[model samples]
Target: MSFAADSPFKSISILYRKSHIWLNEGCIPCDLTAAQAIVIMIVCDFSTLTQDEITKRLSLDKSVIAKTVTKLEERGFLQRTTNPKDKRTYDIHPTEKAWQVYPHIREQVEACFCRMTQTMSEEDRQNFRRLLDTAARAALNQEE
Candidate 1:
């Protein structure tokens, strides 16, 4: 069979799509879609963050983050209280339920990475990770 020419964009696109599918399936037990699971993981890591903080960190649209946060709050995975320092903004925090599923969410994330790099040697994995980080930073126009 003929192979397609090497293209980083094509490879990255495929990886992004496939990883999302894999993560979504893995998160099924937690009753979360991939997006919700990701929001939970971020909130759990920070303990408390404003919706704007989450949006900036994830580089997602504000409306999307707002909707996700609302859904998470309704489902008991998160709690939102008016930020004391800024009454107009809400501070998002993971609930006991979110903590309960934190490990599983982390496991799914780790498993996805492991599967993605399973074929690579340890050194190759390290190099690939480093290169990917650099590329990401460049794409974001961030200083190294």
Candidate 2:
């Protein structure tokens, strides 16, 4: 019933951005850039996604993704292998180091978020997720 401007999306987004400072600090155990974190998170959740597939899911700028993937590969976190079915395309696979770090990263991110929301009830969390999704669509899917 309300417009995107009327939603609490801004507050939620700001909160996430602020909390993600931990991700940006150079001291994080992951030793990863924000872009690397993004790539790692995506692959951790959905194993064996193509670069193009990641592009669509993230809607991130192609250049940023390319730089991030290159850095990650150079840092020994992942690698690009030719797609068996499509010679022109490449698939990303996490390295042993990436496999080892991913579980820890997932745990840390979850713990950070869980600690932040310790007071919220289950129903409230569910409602917030639904509202957030609706608000995100409204905000991001604006017509020209």
- Go through the candidates in order and give each one's C-alpha lDDT: 0.90, 0.73
Candidate 1 local lDDT, 5-74, one digit each (tens): 5776777887789889989999999989889999999999999999999988777899999999999999
TM-score of each: 0.90, 0.76
Superposition TM-score, candidate 1 onto the true structure: 0.90
Q: In candidate 1, which residue ranges exceed 4 Å CA deviation?
A: 1-5, 141-144
Q: 3-58 in candidate 2: lDDT tens per residue?
A: 54666677677657855765555227678755577688787677777888777667
Model 1: weakest 10-residue lDDT segment is 1-10
Please report the candidate that would top lDDT against the real structure. Answer: 1
User: On a 0 to 100 scale, what is the lDDT of residue 42 in model 1?
Assistant: 98
Relative to the true structure, candidate 2 has a C-alpha RMSD (angstroms) of 4.6
